[model samples]
Target: MSDPFIPFESISYTKRFLADCYERQSFANAKTVSYHTSYSFIYHLQQGRLYLQQAAQAPIEIKPMLLFYGIVQMLKACVLTVDPFYPENSTVLAHGVTARKRKKQGYRFLDDEIKVQKNGLFLHFLDKMFHVKQMPDEKYKMNFLLKQVADMHPLYSTMHNQDISIAVTQKSQSYMISDTILDDLHMTANRFSLFLEQSPNSKSWFHRQKGITALKQQITVPLHAAPTRYQSAPWLSTCDGDIYMLRKREDYCSLPELSIHYLLLYNLSMICRYEAEWWGELHHTFEGNDLPFIKQFLTSTTKKLPLLFEHYLFSINER
Candidate 1:
């Protein structure tokens, strides 16, 4: 056999190029599935967060639409987790369609799909799972967070339509996005990331590995019922849906003895508190010009969110 010439600049370059090519091929061959279980939902939610973080920290000029797109993906994952069989929104076509045509036209808008089904089974599911009646009307509630995300559509469209050359500017040899817009984007991305991770439904191999401990008795603090002043700073929720207030002074003594479930709940509750603070700032500090959009977004988004999020957001804001 005759010796063959290689095309890459170097051996390392050839290896890296081939690896990337194989990765792309593998991704293309992969089939998309509904995230009906805890595992799939967490996976997609984390992927969305990863992309948002990457977009936020990118040094070069990058469209924030990437972040918004990731948020939409997270939203889809969330809705699917609630109702795996939720019908896809179809703008056209009737029930009688050829298989090939159905496959070709199966594409659906995430926003539209969510909106149509929001008030039905999903809402009922939320109410039952999260105790929606106990959640407050206003605040950085889960519903509010989701609404903020949904309201980004108009902003996304505005950014998406802008001329790239005009939207970005070079300053001191570095490209920069508008300070106001960038700040909002960063805040929104961070909020969504926190919400998804702290969400009660959030579960993963990592969390499982930590080992959960089922308590002997229900704590019965009713963390989600009505907000009441507690002497302790952190509270833990048992698997049976009871809350126990953990005193700050006892941390040193109790920290080492607590189970993974308590530790996780405590950490998640803290994140929820942080989210509330951020929501307060965002609500009060936003410019007058943006208030109308924010208000409208909140109204529409809240209507579409699951009831569980509404309660979760309210429960965390209690402290």
Candidate 2:
């Protein structure tokens, strides 16, 4: 059987287009990164235009206009450009990454609005995506990273909110969220992917290869394979910013670690709602008095994830 996921024609067309584009424009005409690899460079409107030129040459029906060579190969390496009128960084562009599925058909709906950017749009796009470094352990200390994560844990919410429901999908049939959510999810997943790809000299989770592998696998499953805990509590969807944090505490919560780490980071205590076995939220507070406990909490939570998947996988096989 053929590989269900790879788009063969699209890959061939992109390779050929890259060669022809470099030939016509000259090497200097394209952007350069610190590395010599062709895919390593930061893509701009010029590169986007080159892709457009290639699309014109081959015109594959499935290809998207804006594609990134991911440091790690996963479901999110390719992204489509949309709403060219909006600045590339506009949060709306992130919304373009969503894969739509109808419950009856069980297939992803493709987007139609993808197009190449002219070089003029590159700088503006870069401006929108600012780098946020891991807070120095000291900064996390200030923010009560330990307490923050504990509070954000999804298990707490699941246990507390009777209105919320938990359902697990099999690995092969996971349902995906909307593009806006997918865009954010992809960006977050890519960050972890690259983190794992790098050979880090400093202290980091990158050293944990198994954890990284499991985390990476978690993001791309079919909805039926992925367990989802959603809240039906009123006023929950309307909340934004810190208010969302507040309302989340009041309504429903979840860890959703299988989805992305940040989701767990944002709603730590919420995971308690998903699995009653979780006890961290009830025991810990962001009191600024304890750091080791918080650090231990982070370590334990991250470690617990693999077991969660093991249980999920075992349950699926049993079914």
Candidate 3:
């Protein structure tokens, strides 16, 4: 099952929270810009919410376009929290990623790819949120993005007979990762332990639970410190009463899950807006695996993206 939608409180009441965020982050001239920044924040957030709400009533043909705008607005709001004066210039306003539309035979959305642009919301978002510098000029495939989500765990398992995750169970202060993950990641316990240590947001180095075999033959290891037990790479999600550490394609390990969501919505929105005939045919024919993957991805996005950003927005309030 996918993550349940747990969007943050309504946008109407978040101006104060946002202003405070500006001040808390100690952005230059926080006092001078917080008012205007908070206003923009509310506008972006409201627009995001409105678009997603509209997408809920939209048909499949139009859903991606609406959802992409919604997702972009949400991201803009998040960026404002950090940048204070976002869009410092017009160049940052572009989609930041471009999709290639080839008329070659057997064109499938699953095999479709999007290339990351050097500057734009995608790059700025990555820099501000994750502090990633110098991404390669590489095209990321849709299938690669799909495999990163926990929601797709069941879908891929059922359809292709391929498992994408290692079951993770959390008990109080620690998470037990399925040792079966060893074969999936092709790493020994020590190597895997080292891998997790190098992940983003590594506050404390985690180690294996000593001298005991966890139930169901899992390896018990605590991922973070108390009260804010965040997951690192090979993501650990506390949602839905279990943790799913998804094993994704190469170069995906370091990316934030939200980035993948953004890329998916970006490409789909491009298809919906620019590739009319192809999109129309796909919707009418219900052909192949693309439809189901896109269907499930949208379902997962509308429900989870806002919640993920909500968690992010509020979490930084502590800083």
Candidate 4:
């Protein structure tokens, strides 16, 4: 008996293996367990955006379904990128087992596992963002998050209902998402990125940690208030000059803390850039009140991301 699991360290290898299996119809009898890296999710996210762009031109009957799938892919991408160590466990059954034995043992579908993992990730994000605690009822938590997300972006409500129907019936239905929904998705992604930036080590839940305590001590400047009017330099004559600088400085006092901010910024910028490339420019996509710090940082060109961050961002899709 040979080892049942096949390990792939690179996306190219994974792609080739899948393509070969697909061509041979090997998946008809075999199950695939994808051990995806952070970069793999990012790649899928980029592809999802591409599908969304295509959905705009698709016929009305199928447009909603396309958009729904696209948004789901982006959501999965967010979960994976935010916490690459998710699921936290792996299992492999012995190969060459009889189909009858597998049936008797009650095998689990990889798709079901993915849905469970993604739902957990979504719940975690909502709990932290809304400051909810000790919600033991899984169905209630899921419904609560769905309603909140729908309220935040009305388009999500329709999509959510349609998705639920599709899941229950295992059939596709016609649905449509507005261009405005893309902006909502962008804002949601930014908010999650900000949460990740603020607490890098706070992975399990929203509880305070000793690492955050140490980091907070290093942040001497206040993060709540806007910069004073006279903080501009004499050499600079631009409007609202140095406001971005002040905000960035106030957010992170040390290089390590700044690195976290850079990581989030890089991820957000990648999403923004992808949107821009696919659908012209992004105008008023983000709200100032919702993410003032992110708006400021993105508008300013005075500061550059750390060299290491730039390297990792560009190399994420490399073979």
Candidate 5:
């Protein structure tokens, strides 16, 4: 297998990344901190790479445990680059989110929800890395989060018979979106256009083509939120190839991709660790939609997270 982190594993690469962060932050102790912190940052990322590599080959039963640790390691590395004084308190050391202690009967992973806590890694990571602070007590269902992942749309199409993602074509600086987004949105073209105008994410909404809608993203949009901040949808522009728009655009759908993955993986890791009875049944029995979604999700995250890490850390988009 080729190196998942070829030049990225090099110490110099992390040093440069840290140097950039130091410059961006203008830290008072940049000289001392950058030197010492680079070592920890590089190792955390390397360990993350290792854990995710193991997850890819590991059996389905053990994959989530590996993925959770892998994700945490990467998150720690990311935190260091952004905020050198991470773990300023013990609260940031915690996972920062909680799963239900006792799952109700007939529980499906899709319907299961996780509560964002007041403090911990989840809170710290999002606030530090993405500049977004969410309501701690809010609850999010697994299916809602999963729908935010564009690649997972196919499984949803198969199982739920829904199009969670729409492919977009680029036209110069803007992108051409599909009007199919309006189907489930219950909005006419004019209302949908009006909706985009009010959305924080929308820089400009061009006219709808034969069936295409076009918009340039407001790249500098600050990610602060009100209760209705998520009334808008998410638009991710890949460095290369196709772009996708998630339909419906509900709450959390507009969240940064990193946060989306972290939340999904957190719930998954919890189910893997705590809900063994249900997890075992899903794996061994392979009867319901749960196993398929679980298997597909694990597969999706394993492939996508590393590439996303590269983008977050180094501005490199591998795919």
Candidate 6:
């Protein structure tokens, strides 16, 4: 219950932001299906944005609010899964249901990808994730995404689809599903911003109740695709297959209290490493350092750590 936003000095500005990261929900609330859907989506979206920056070789910026939105989307996807924690990964972990499934299946793909059985339920789940429901006008385009563009345009044309530009060698390599997802996400985020501007309901709730919109704003975006770093062997399939830990009461109690700080600290480390890697890449491309700009932006931005714990105090951890 201590502040998760205490900053570290050794890492880059992005890493600093990561080190200080806090979730709007506690591990207890985060383990539920509802939180999983909303939270994970937002996480996935931010990861998607990060992937885009990597592809473009652009300077990394920390937009915690935007990332929070992405985590929500990932949560939604996780809730939809048959087994929230144990979907098949490219590499077998020494833990739960997925490892058992891999052993039974017996066949592996060329790149050690799981030869996932054509389960209708699984495919249905994936379809929903890829297919966009809300259209601009409910017509014109079917929530256009990367799969659509890759199918239509040439490799070069596809590169220009995303706002960020990246140097890729192969046609397939250049086309990232994350880019397309971000386009849709940006539209929704812009719409949400407009909604806030127009309606006072945003402060309370559409129905006269206390809504968690303020808490939701903490994460910037959900993940569109898994991190590109996991695209290689061992982690490839798992990377593609969304791995979400839902907001369930059992899971919440299950997480050892001692591990909570360590778990969070580990993620903080990841954020730092990822940020440093991105910064190095940006330096390689752009020449002069922009760490100061990143630091200033992060320092100025408000964090939702207190709000996250406040929201969860009554709902999940009540005695």
| Candidate with best lDDT | 3
lDDT of 4 by residue, 139-177 (tens): 221122211111122232233433211010011221112
lDDT of each: 0.29, 0.26, 0.72, 0.29, 0.70, 0.26
List runs of model 5 lying over 4 Å from the truth.
1-4, 180-233, 236-241, 316-319
Q: Is candidate 3 or candidate 5 better by TM-score?
A: 3
- State the lDDT of candidate 2 residue by residue for 1-319, as single tens digits: 2322222225443344344434443445222211222232224323433433343343221111211211111111111111112333454333221111211222111111122132322222222211112111111121222223322334335434531212212233332222232243234544534532342211221233333222333433222122211111111121111111222222222212222222222223222333223223324543332224323434443333323333322232122
Worst 10 residues of 2 by lDDT: 234-243
Q: Best candidate, TM-score-wise?
A: 3
TM-score per prediction, in order, is: 0.23, 0.20, 0.87, 0.25, 0.82, 0.19
In order, what is each prediction's RMSD in angstroms? 21.9, 22.5, 3.9, 21.1, 6.0, 19.7
Q: Which stretches of candidate 4 lie over 4 Å from their true place?
A: 1-36, 89-121, 127-319
lDDT of 3 at 229: 24
The better candidate by TM-score, 2 or 4, is 4
Candidate 1: tens digits of C-alpha lDDT, residues 1-319 = 1211122224443334333433443433222322123344445555655654564454212312334334444444434433333334432112111111121222211111111122332233233323233221211222212122323334434634531111222233222233332243333433423432343433311132322222332111112222211111122222222333211121211111111111222222232243345334435765333334334433332222222222322232232
TM-score-based ranking: 3, 5, 4, 1, 2, 6
Q: Give model 3's TM-score versus the native structure.
A: 0.87
- Model 6 lDDT per residue over 22-103, tens place: 1232223333443334334334434534432232332234343333233232223232332333235532221111111221
Q: CA lDDT of 212 in candidate 6?
A: 14
* lDDT minimum window of 10 residues, candidate 5: 221-230
Per-residue alpha-carbon lDDT of candidate 3 for residues 144-196, written as tens digits (9 for 90 to 100): 87877777778888878877676776676677677877667777777776666
lDDT of 2 at 132: 15
